[model samples]
Target: MKENYTILAASHISGVPTESIRAWERRYKALTPQRLQNGRRSYSTEDIEKLSLLNKLTHEGHSIGQIASLSTKNLKNLYQKHSPQRHPLAEDLIKHLHDFDMEKISEIIEESKLTLETRSFVLDFAAPILSEVGILVENEKMTIAQEHIISSILRSHFGTLLQISANLKPQKRFIFTTPEGDFHEFGILLCAALCLSRRIGIHYLGPNLPAHELIMATKMLSPKAIILSVARLPKDLQKVDIPTYLKEVRTHTSASIPIFVGGDGYRPRSSADKGIQFLPTLAEFDKMLENFTK
Candidate 1:
């Protein structure tokens, strides 16, 4: 059976706005979507692929009016001509992401790991893949369950990667986790992967580590640094104030141990915050890693 998608779903999957999709269809006849019984537009998988190609070409400087009626094969040739350096697996992985084909997704990830070096795999492939899936989730194109499925697969692979690298001439070690109220793990997981690629030993404590427990773990592990990821929390879901939480962790932990925090939910709200380093992006975190090694 062929799959059919509503205009909104097509927009989400194809990275084209609904307004643009309609404009292209109406003005240029770029696509001819099927009309449902109630007269709503429904796109097919093929239509989405064509739209994705068209979107890519338009962003790369092609005029929509000039290329709207090209065949899919011709559009793909144009895409390659324009972006020859594009990762080979990206388009395939995105298709599988939308299709929810877990096996294919895992296969593509494994293939990329084998083909690219650790740093390249993380920067070029893994990071982009996670970011795309995250956008899909944020746009409501994918459900939380789908996000969890991808996360679980990535966590298992990254855990293994971290363990293998940490055993090989590891330098400074860092403890990675989220606070008690924050349950998201993807941010820290990617961070840990980057650290591993740099041969930085990581004792990943996973997410939602209570302040007290984190203190105890810190004492036992005595890592060179502590890294925390705090994702955005709805008001009703917040268990403790972030500033207070940071204060508690700082107070109990050794003053010498540097604490680095990152993610969307953290912003130093007041002057009381001290001894906490906020890294807003992975690039910043990597820079900190370089400083530690020096």
Candidate 2:
């Protein structure tokens, strides 16, 4: 029942030249369009979106040869990071943050909550703003205190959203939390928000929980899965060893319950960790959740 577009239609919609699309397809295997009975190429809606994203990134100076292989989700994230135009509301919020207008900041966030759908508010609005604020702090354009203030505001709002979503009919329930010493929680908070938006129930245990305590919680809850976000690196790897923590949790918990880890802190091992799946992006996580429900 899905519509298919011809190469010319795909080009018109995606803004990529037919020649370039073919070249990317042949050279980089960027997309494999279906061949109709007459041997004409047919592209689906997803293919068109991917082409559009590729066209945008390529125009922004990315090498097609380099980026053609990246997932559409990664491509979108890259575009978000490199785009010249920031989201208007995010830009306004950032300006207010610089002025330290606490009241105005709260008002803007509350306004966003009311105006945008839960998913858009979290992923498209709140996520980007948090990421931009981190950059501001790194460049010293904003202080740590300002960063914390906005984080606190977003966190409080997310908590309220979580409670509201908890009452929805859940497709699956997962335990969401951050490990000890990984106090940076926005990544997990955003993930939790994304999950909740889809009626996925989250048993959110707040940050800085020790490994053994996580095992105990897992045993008690027996959730569909356990998801941890390790966005911030610990000062001492020896003290907050990810491999050790994962091994401990795996050994103690039931093998039937899968463990998913996300964020920048944990790297995928050369040999993938047993009984664990690493979802590196929010888009990928959402896709996996879709597959789970199906």
Candidate 3:
């Protein structure tokens, strides 16, 4: 089944702003959405692909006036011209996905590990390929099963990498997890692998962790910090209440322990929630680790 997403979700998936989507609809007739009886715009995966293409082209110097009406295929052809090197490794991984060649996927991942340094492997190559797989799945170019296969294989790769350095004494420690509503584990796993690369110990508690359980673990482990990852936000406008969940988690933990929240779905908000800091990307996370250790 083709996936249908809300405008907000589309904004996140396509890297387009909600305001821009509305403007494009009203002004440029970029792409029409299916409207509900209540007047909410439901964006299809195809709509997301169009918006994503538009967003990529605009970023690469194309004007909306010139390309907003173009088909998704045409926009993609133009985008490749602009971002010729967007993700060189991404294409091969995606191709392997389409072919159901898990062995070749593992070969590419392992080769990346041996050729690139840990940070480059994780940030530059691994991250981009996984993100592209996510896009392919989101845009319906790949099956959900294919996405899971890629993720599971990569997860094993990361596990081996993390284990090799287990004997190294860590300079800092953190507990990485997601709340009960967020089921994505790859984000935190990647985060853990990155931290491990820097000799930063991470007590990673996979996903769907309850707040009370997290609070209990915090008390038991007394980690230097907590890193909560949220990979998806609620699509309903009325349900975008993740801040409340952030606050609830904060309430159960110590004010002195810095809690960081991040992932694709995180929205920018005031860091007024005591001890809750948002690190939106791995680069920012590296800076955070550097600053914390300093």
User: Which residue segments of model 1 deviate by more than 4 Å?
Assistant: 1-88, 165-171
Q: Tens-digit lDDT track for model 2 on 73-145?
A: 6787687677654556777898899999988888888788788887778766888888878866876878999
Writing each residue's lDDT as its tens digit, candidate 1 over 1-294 gives 355888887887677999999999999999999999999998877788799889989988899999999987678667654563346686677678788898998899889878987666665666666666676687687887877776777778887886686567665788999999788887888888878867788898999988999999999999898999998787679887787888999999999999989876765432446999777567678888777777
User: Root-mean-square deviation of each candidate, in angstroms?
Assistant: 12.4, 11.0, 6.3
Q: After superposition, how far is residue 53 of candidate 2 from its true place, in Å?
A: 15
Q: What local lDDT does model 3 show for residue 269?
A: 39
lDDT of each: 0.80, 0.81, 0.77
Ranking by TM-score: 2, 3, 1
The digit string of per-residue lDDT tens for model 3 on 141-256 reads: 88899988878878888877667756666756799898776787777877788787677897878787878788999999888999988876546532325666678889988888
TM per model?
0.66, 0.70, 0.69
Off by over 4 Å in 2: 1-61, 64-86, 165-171, 234-238
- Model 3 misplaced stretches (Cα beyond 4 Å): 1-87, 233-241, 270-274
- Show pairs that collide, candidate 2: none
Steric clashes per prediction: 0, 0, 0
